[model samples]
Target: MTVSFGDAGVVDVLDDEDKSDEAKEEVDSRDEEKTEKGVLESELSGEPYIFDYDSFRVEWKVVSHWEGACNVSVSLTNKSDETIHNWNLSFLSEDEIINPYNARITSEGSDGNKWTFKNLEYNQDIRSGESIQFGFQINYGERIDIPFSYSIDSSEKKVSDSDYEISDQIISSWDGGAVGELHIVNNKDTAIEDWTVTVRTDAVFLTVWGGNIKKVSEDTYEFSCPDYCQNIAPGQTAVIGYQLSGHDTSIEILGLKEWGNKDNTISGNSISDNSVSNNTISENSVSNNSVSDNSVSENKPVTYIESDGHQHIFIDSDEYELLEEGIYLLDVYSDSMTGYINYENEDQNDSDNENYNEIKVESVKLEICDVFDETIWEGDILSDDGFETWSAKDTGFVLGANKLIFDVIFSDDTALKEELIIINREASNIKNTFIELTDEDDDNIYDYYEKYFGTDPDKKDTDGDGLEDGVELFLLDTDPTDDDTDDDGIKDGDEDEDGDGLNILKEYELGTSDLSDDCDLDELSDDYEVNVLGTDPTFADTDFDKITDKEEIDLGLDPLNPDSDGDGIIDGDETITREVSKDYNGEAIDKVSVNIGCKGSMENKLFISKASDKSGILHDTAGLIGDFYDIECDADFETADIVFSYDESMLGDTDESDLRLIWYNEETREFVLLEDSVVDTENNTVSYTTTHFSDWGVVDGKAYEEAFDTPNTPGMSGTDNPYMNNDKFKCCDIA
Candidate 1:
């Protein structure tokens, strides 16, 4: 309908219909439409409908009304409460049709509140005193979800009463590629379901092919519109086209759950797999569901920064799921929020972190307040023109988030709060999974597992010793993955036993001190590591029970001790055993002790001097004893010699008063007194000297061999061999 307004800016509410003066004669000629007579007391005595044009607000108080064939008419109640002034007539558009409209009606009131309608719905009779009251109404451009209530009286009306609303649009979503039709409700409240519908959405590439939304059961639904269905009579809402794709960035989530598969389609009849989703772990991220889904992920956008006028940015990691903790680099985005924030690093040594053992992150510099344990290691912060890092001395470091307030100088002295998350790795957990195990051709661990288990693990045999995979993995404190388990920049496999890597014999540091392997990294191969390196394999150093890497090279000293010196001499100058066993009550029992004799040495001299042993210098007080018999003669004496032989039966003396035998327990490194036993003879030397023995004396290298039966003893044996009876030379020939 084309709306045309008069000079008064008031448009005829009838839309395109027309009227004329000769229209009166035209109405009279139409006598087929009857009318009632007799001084028709037609009334219209009420205020006009008023509204604030500026704000579009209205106020009203009910006054009077009249009933029509197809609509209701009312007269507004004026404030005076005397007469029915303003009037209006309302009707539903439910009967709107594409066919022609025939409207003819008239309202004549004396209070200048007169409305003449031509071709509008006409009335049949109006007798005197049977006043017809009507009110005016203005239709705003926009449709509001307004509350409406009305009652009907006994009358023959064409319109039916029903609770319905007027809307120009409808929305819905579908699973399958199912297409639905539209349903239209007629003036009689009868639905006509038929015509097809198409729907679309502004979201990228998203579309629903159906239009009709039907209410089936109390909750369930069956949406189908065909020629037999109630649809598209007139004024029925229908969808044209709809689609939805989505933005790759800015999670335009479409799933019903807060987090789940976005693209999932379940068939109406399918019961085998209705839910299409998968959950992992017990963190409640994803859930196990029917198999039917689709999705895509990518990194989050990066925000750049202007730290010291240098444009740096945080790289996007939105797409990748962050599980474990580590450092990362974020790229820069030109337009980003971080461009104003400040960050920094405070490393004192300023060593080229390119060789950083821990994970790396973007370094920067900024001024911030901190509480430090000054007595401990204090990290020096090194800053350049562009960047710096927040350095953490050997102590603990914490990075608080926006909870910590900071005054940024670069972006003015603004007190800005932001999330600060810098994490430094603690070396206490660093361990060498590799160790020197037994190997044939040195395939690391192949020979070990091959010989016993018939299978080999990926092992790193740091030492060339002939052991298998776990020999070093469990014992040597080596890394299985790296050939040079220590990562001291030395190959564990190629490390020389005498070199810095293998030889704890000369190594100094053995603690998790800034210069030590914090975790006592290795626990394998404590043998050679102790002996060879002179390291305390059990304890890292004397007094310091924690082992270190340097001493791990030694096979003797304990690799895990920080104190090789028991007397508080931690520098290894005087390493003493320090082990105190604690009782169940946590009290210290005098930590038990065991003496292990010095075993292997490059020097072939296995035994030290008797004097040195008796001195009680060796640990656990284990040493040799002094005995002239052990020095000059064999135990089971049978050899004929110039020196006297011993026989308890032929004893010349029985007590200390007469003089007797003296012997020393070599193993105990102490002298033992003999009983009052008799001696056959007192012994000396074949050829005695004043101060010392000959260059080729028994002490030089030779020791008396085991005893045997005598063949001949010059003057004693009666054997016949003449050479065996020669004893006169040294005594007579010398004269």
Candidate 2:
């Protein structure tokens, strides 16, 4: 089947053979005819059919058509001042829509004549003066009916300013600035449309957000909701904030008006002509009807000023003394100054002068310059007590000469300038003057220095270390507030000055100098004797062991411990006898001599002693000639030769060559003989080379069988003993 479309609203459906010939003739005949319908006239001329509404306009066009279906393009333009979001366009037509793009068919009439199309996510918002287009195909019986009498609907509900309740609040305030927020609340049952608020203020705006701002006049500003926040739903508030300079200025709400409707407005309160001091705002000053100032204080005394046409600005008086022309002297401690600009205007009510209203001072600035004429500091001065004051808290004046300049500008664009030279005195002169006048503790250290060094001015010795605060800080080069300057647990006054034998306290007590190393004429210094050797500095021999501390240290012995090697013999005695022994019932026995050849420091002294009776190892062996000796050293060593002295009477029937040295292995619970054992007949000692230290004893090699046959040793039972088979004695390896 084939179809043909003509400009005269004619569509003919025919078979394929007659379509080409009949459609050409029908179109040619329709071109010469005219239709009274507006859609038909527009389609014939290939122009769009336009439909106008109060808020938006629509244009419908038929691009192409066939026998039963036609492609149509429609564009929507928002004509109102407010933006339209999530909008729906509805129109009455006799065609059915299909294959829509950039739009969704939301609902259709029962007869399919009325259709409503909603916007897609990407094209939902149609801002003012902006247009969006969409296309779709429509099917008709014989002719396409272009959509007309269209209407655009959105979430926006048009309402007058009376539908909202406006309120202004100061969010925060600082020294010279403040932040304010305006809350526009919708009181109606539906969402409120675009709203604009007119505000009058003398404060300079720094930043604004959540709305659009338009400067209507010098002191009037219009704030309107942006597209995102235009539609304020019921019981919801649209908030906007602005940061502004001038803390003392008042912000007044003049009116609240609807967008695109100038006549529909809610008139606010008249601006207050009264002036308030101390950053106060009057009641009913913002808006009289619904808007209110929620944060400011109420019912303050207002001042009325009679105005003249001209304004005169000048300096009242100079605060600092003038040393020369254009030169003044300012104290180093004076960080701020006042009384530079005149606070009140002089009376100028003269008949010859025109009666003009007085203009207010808009702003004041203070700038400080160095000797080189370069601006060192510049800032705005805030009005306080009717006078403009500036503080130099952040950047203080440099010591020496400086230039101070002030500039005052009035609201009428007239300005006045004043200049003066300021000389800041040197800091040392101020310090000396303060020191001579203030000393609380009478310690000769001034209160000024005490505060500077973080010390207590009322205390002679801050740390109570027996030294004055001044002496500790100046003479001793120590912290005045801390007793232990080096944190070594010693007070400052008790510390040694020159590695001397006497501390400052002792030197003062004895009337001796603290610089001497040995106050008692001893060879040892105080630091070495007391700290290093752990000995008394006043006495020559600390341990009373017949050996001086210096002599003991020179001979590689500990002065604090009389028995340096843990043997029964004293260090002084051991040096002469060349032997160490263990005490048995207060008598020396089991004497031993050790020759350590190692490559490490001996942190602990070498010790040698007979094993106690509580030892679990079996000791009653026939081959053992002497008590088992426990020898140890808390040091790392590769090898050492230990000689164990044995009584000759205990050898009974055993030859000197038959003597052998053996060691008990703790891990294996076995006693093994040393292969490199030497018997010294002259010294009656049995010696052996050992790489490590453990229990050792002298034994007769000829009675090795009797020693190995002994049983019931700890960790040695039955076949568990390594020497149970009675093989040749083997050397035990000790690590």
Clashes of each: 146, 0
Clashes, model 1? 146
Top-scoring candidate (lDDT)? 2
Cα deviation in Å at residue 638, candidate 2? Answer: 64
- Give the Å shift of residue 514 in candidate 1: 29
Given candidate 1, what's the lDDT at residue 718?
50
Query: Which residue runs does candidate 2 get wrong by more than 4 Å?
Result: 1-71, 77-92, 96-129, 134-139, 147-162, 247-249, 254-735
Which candidate tops TM-score?
A: 2
TM-score of 2: 0.27
Per-residue lDDT over 316-422 for candidate 1, one digit per residue giving the tens place of the 0 to 100 score = 33321222221122222111112222343332124664443332333333321111101111223222323322322122222110011122222211111122222
Residue pairs clashing, model 2: none
- Worst 10-residue lDDT window for candidate 1 reads 699-708
